[model samples]
Target: MKASSGYAGVPRWVLAIAIIGALFVVLPLVAMVVRVNWGQLIPLITSKESTDALLLSLRTSGAATLLCIIVGVPMALVLARTRFPGQRIVRSLVLLPLVLPPVVGGIALLYTFGRQGLLKAPMDFLGIQIAFSTTAVILAQTFVALPFLVLSLEGALRTVGTRYEAIGATLGAGPTTVLRRITLPLVLPALVSGAVLSFARALGEFGATLTFAGSLQGVTRTLPLEIYLQRESDPDAAVALALVLVAVAILVVGLAHQASLGNAGGRQRLL
Candidate 1:
């Protein structure tokens, strides 16, 4: 006759393992926070180099997020709404950056845009250079962050399905009309979540930007790169910057989660 606590049914071993997993992820963050030189935290993170890197990271990551949305949304729609030969392979390739090492992705970008790369002749003819520039930093971030948007939006599209789309067609709505009015509105929350996640990923990009763009303060030296450089000469500054990065990441992740919850709520209303 006793009232049950929902979690009481979970096995003790499972609960213990889950607690351990949470601690494993959390303890390092706690340790870093403990290591911070609190008295110098503001000064360390407010230095010229730190501010420059932080600004450049924000700029490039913003550009990268925009680029991801411009391209990733269409890619998601194609993957979710259509069937074609080699579709699985294409999706796999599109999502490759999610699993590939950042350094490897940077290498691939280098060979595609470097002076001696495949398009070298055309680039030289056009008097354009992409390597080791702010553009390169943006491209590197986009390369790695694109998959997050694509994957998120695609899953949402699949879950929402094509029933409403078909009905729109029967009601004399054209494809573009149906898409702009019905499909996009239904998936707006997912799109926001994906875009925020892409921004976070781009903000944290390091290995790819370093390998392709080369760190130059106020240019290609993003916060992550700045943190790495500071780690060699000023551990306090490095830790401070790392904490800043972690805070921004946490904020972005919270936004994504809220957007996801909104999407779930919207679906329930639809039901």
Candidate 2:
């Protein structure tokens, strides 16, 4: 396509570098796919351990997605609409986990929610133990995944601007009405895209979940953790599990791309 578009301005070295970068990303995935045991793929991933991890991943990730949406949408709205002291700092903090190492984030969660940590007395009195539990898995997933939803939703809110909201207010609509009727519909695509990205991130989460939730089989052993364990003695099963993740990643990208296209089409229709 670049060649067909009359890309005469591009230098040979630039194209070479671009191809090399693409190869770096594509080669490893291709290797995984190529090495997959085609005949035993089904049996490998459907085994008890595989099924447990896969199911746990889906459940925790789904819970995390819901948590992100609930908390993240409001946070995004606040960031996009409000002006206050240290606003930049708040925004940075909201996105801090995105750049922070997963293991580091897990430790942070541990400090905040662990038995002997900040909320220890409150949790202990209530008989709630978060760390090293399935609940801990969901909590850790939420910690790492929240930023994806927030950043995407905040961008969406800004792109939507405040024109419609202002008009609605001028016409006697309350803030809640405007938000429910105008702002939400406008940002629906972004919401879906963000949620998909968050779910994918949670599904692939490893370091944080491992540190916070522990790899207890049928409890906290998610797909990635399971893949790591399988690699030691069951390379074929690991490959099969890895393929499952690759398929999920592909689906997530496809959904986000489709959402983008839908949003573009919606704007064209509005125009």
Candidate 3:
């Protein structure tokens, strides 16, 4: 295809960088596929422990994702739309977990919420024990995954703008009504993308989940934790579980890409 006069302004390096970036992203999956032993993959995937870890991964990751949406969305709204003292620091802090080592995050969680830690008195008073429990797994996942939701949603909120919500207010729509009828639909793609990213991260989370939640079968042992344990004793099962995680990560990226394309299409149609 010949470039239009306007399109001729695009630089060749931009295209080269994009191609390189795509290959970088895809190389791991290509390697995984090439390394997979198909004959034993199904058996490993179907084993009782594998199935339990997978089910636990799905359940805990799903719960953590829902918690992320419920909590992170409102925080994103505030961070994107509100101005206040310490706002810069708060925004940075909100994203701090993204930069923090997952192991450190788990240690931090333990220091704050572990049975003998800082909040132990109050937590115990409430009859809630955090460490070594399924709830602890969810909390650890949420801690590590929440920032993805907040950052993505905050970016989307910035793009969507508050103008529509203001218009809704001018039209006498209540805050809840305005959010549900105007803002949310506009930011839905971002929310979905963020949620999926959080879920993917949660599914693959290891260090933090292992440290804070502990590896207990049918309880806190997520797929990543199980895979790590299996890698030492059962290489085939480890590869099989790793493949499952890879498949899920691919699915999440695919869905995010499709949503973005759909959003672009909608914009083009509107234009």
For every model shown, the clashing-pair count is 0, 0, 0
Candidate 3 weakest lDDT stretch, 10 residues? 262-271
- lDDT (0 to 1) per candidate: 0.97, 0.93, 0.89
Instruction: List model 2 lDDT by residue over 1-271, tens digit each.
Output: 5353324777777888999999999999999999999999999999999999999999999999999999999999999999999999999999999999999999999999998889999998999999999999999999999999999889988887899899999999999999999998988988999999999999999999999999999999999999999999999999999999999989998998898777767666765
TM-score list, all predictions: 0.97, 0.95, 0.90
Best by lDDT: 1
The regions of model 3 sitting more than 4 angstroms off are 1-25, 265-271
lDDT of 3 at 146: 98
**In model 1, which regions exceed 4 Å deviation?**
1-8
Model 1 — TM-score against the truth?
0.97
Q: Model 2 reaches what TM-score against the true structure?
A: 0.95
Over the stretch 1-271, how does candidate 3's per-residue lDDT look in tens digits?
9664432576777777887999998897788777778999999998989999999999999999999999999999999988999999999999999999999999999999998889989998999898889999999999999999999889878876788889999999999999899888887877888888899889889889988999999999989988999999998788888999887888988887776666556545534
Q: Candidate 3, overall lDDT?
A: 0.89
For model 2, the local distance difference test gives 0.93
